[model samples]
Target: MIFFIILGAVFAAVFLLTLFFSMPAFQKNAPASSLGKLSFFDTKGKKHHPNPTFVERIVLPIFRKFLSIFRKFLPRNLVESVSKRLELAGIQDNVKVDVFLGIKFFMPFVFLLALFFISIFFKVPTTLKMILILLVPVSYIFPDYYLKSKTAKRQEGIRKSLPNALDLLTISVEAGLGFDMALYKVAENIKGTLGEEFKRVIKEMEIGLSRKEALRNLTKRTDVTDLNTFILSIIQADIFGISIGKVLRIQAGEMRIKRRQAAEEKGMKAPVKLVFPTILFLLPALMIIVVGPAILSIMDILKVMGQ
Candidate 1:
């Protein structure tokens, strides 16, 4: 139709115009005239001369505005919850939970939209129509289950690594470095859950918080049983002016023993856990393979005798 043709032409024209206007911005290398200097156009169509880094000119503003809009819609309470969760997970720096919550909010809409399209395509049964609706919201939230599992695993790793990190800290402290410097040194050398917590603790100390207060905050954020005990030990040692090295060495040995005990418990449970699967699945298959031919031969003999 003439109307369709005109609409297509208009769309093509708009697309070309957009591509033309945007091409200069997408160029990998700046124009020869602007070599060693940065240039950008302002929103008002005026050429404002300013030095801009490649990321500042190309990426940061776009990402910043996107995050700003996203944050505007995210609930503060949800952000707080995410922040707390991240803190417990030992990720403390350069992340905003509002961004995460915004993604969470958007994910449900996207999943629902996908479900709507799938329901239309498949002509899903009326009896199961409710499942499709439920699946949309459920799938959206499914990622949180994965996130929680990862966080738990990371926390466990941190808990297991804490004693070693603490011993190193105690050594560094006893070797003439201040507690804060020792924390930094340990954080630098170690790479795990406890290392991340120590890194944040060091950052806090650098910002003027006392060593004890920072360690206490770390304990609160982690909520790990072993970490709590370790912090208490540190606090007590500080209060009594006892040598930290002795306390740390004892704690580390105890933690290693606990790790060994946990491993032994898991080994003990493995056989019991495997028994059900072996009985239910493998045993039946084995019995069928062993007795099947014998049963067939017995039936054949009986048939021959009757004949």
Candidate 2:
């Protein structure tokens, strides 16, 4: 027994040493270069380019090409649907959507690989195996759900902040700044969803788009009814040469009233929303605290009588 125990200990030590020595080599063999070579052109008809590293020149392009072909086999409609959903979720930036789709496309494979390793390591049962198989697809789509929820929350925040933003814009405009300049000033001062939207509007104007067009685009991007109405009012006022400050003041007042009503509605719903949790979670605990001592006393009395 002692001989066998010594042999097992030696085997274990050797195995650990081998694993430790092999890990760094395995990591070194893994690919590191993922991006393409960067190239630039000079003014005097000269081009500058970085020579591609071995992995970049040989391996990465092959992997990208293989991915391109693999992507062709995927359903076009499904990709389009995902893109549209992402657009609605306020991931309107093309580059971000591309990255998101790339991640989505790769995530299921990674999840399946993880599941494969886990099953191999743990010898999970068949029922759990089926559940993990389902989770692979779920993990792939989870980011989309998260992004949608974020977008909704952001939109709600913007809605809540709208009246204050409009009031500030009105004050700025009334203080002799042009509408575009007022928007720029408001974007600089504020720091939330409203500010972000206004910043985008300012950027569009800076890039030579008209104020009306930028505001209209902002409405379309946000899809908020109040903003849409505000934009329409501004356009109409612009067409008729009305005072912009007066228009903004009126709009701000209406928005403030709407916000107040929304708050009241939420307050009214709070009791109804609390009812289920109060009954399910808190009421049971309250009953236990109130009746526990009495129940214990009665049980003790019954025990004494039996004795």
Candidate 3:
């Protein structure tokens, strides 16, 4: 009887959710012609508009509501910090601060709901209960960790690509293009995090910011020491009437050397990193293969001697 009640509840929930999303209030203001088309997820294409799935229609309203409610409770400084971190992660183009905070708030409740349903099906041990309790806080903080990881990956990509970008910029400048023109050329040629940042700097410059100010903002956004030092060199060169090509050429050489050294350092540490895994996994498997037969033979001989 309880099983039937729970099953009915699930069906009713689904029906109500479907009805809620299908209502006129949740429908997009897009024209009728743009509606009823199939859309799929694409990494390089715009998603979630002009062709939203039923799930999106259902979830987006709740997501927006959560965002609006949570936005009021978030402090101004926290919002700004999160916005900056998201920008550093390259996701600010896609997700806003309010949406991010909404997810941060929403994920914990989702985790709790999942835990509740799971506990209903199976008996949760004390340890599992404690873990489920701990998961709420972990889920709440997961957005920040995800942002940090993305930022780290982006920074690493920029670090690897910066030298090549600088080299391209150097060549462009040496080829008689001005610094701004060189930036445009590099943005056109490169296709990674560094290229995107250069494009942003160019936009800032176009919006009335001085080259030095735009470059400084780039360093601030990236928080990369090598890039910051390179920016400092460019700023100093621009101030002291030094040649741009000379500065870029020197910075490129230094960045290339640093990248090589970093690669070599990581390679050198590979064996050290393998040590614990070798002892824990490979050694045990080897021992089982080599010693298993010997143990079995000894047991058989001992039984015979006893008889």
Which one is best on lDDT? 3
- Between candidates 2 and 3, the one scoring higher on lDDT is 3
Which lDDT tens digits does candidate 3 get at residues 68-164? 7778787989888887886666543223566667667665675576567657776556685676678689867766786787688878988888888
Q: What C-alpha lDDT does candidate 1 achieve relative to the native structure?
A: 0.64
Q: How much lDDT does each candidate structure score?
A: 0.64, 0.67, 0.72
| Candidate 2 lDDT by residue in tens digits, 1-307 | 3334334534543443333223221122111110011112112353445895664477445644655666567688866765565544555533333445555655566546555665666655677568658866875776677667766776787788788889999999999999988988988887776776777776666667888898887776677788889889998899899999999999999999999999999999999999999999999999999999999999999999999
Ordered by TM-score, highest first, the candidates read 3, 2, 1
Instruction: Tell me the deviation in Å of residue 115 in model 3.
Output: 7.8
- In terms of TM-score, the best-performing candidate is 3
> 18 in model 2: Cα distance from truth in Å?
30
Task: Give the CA lDDT, 0 to 100, for residue 126 in model 3.
Answer: 67
Which pairs of residues collide in candidate 3?
none
Ranked by lDDT, top first: 3, 2, 1
In model 1, which residue pairs have backbone atoms overlapping below 3 Å? none
Score every model by TM-score: 0.65, 0.70, 0.74
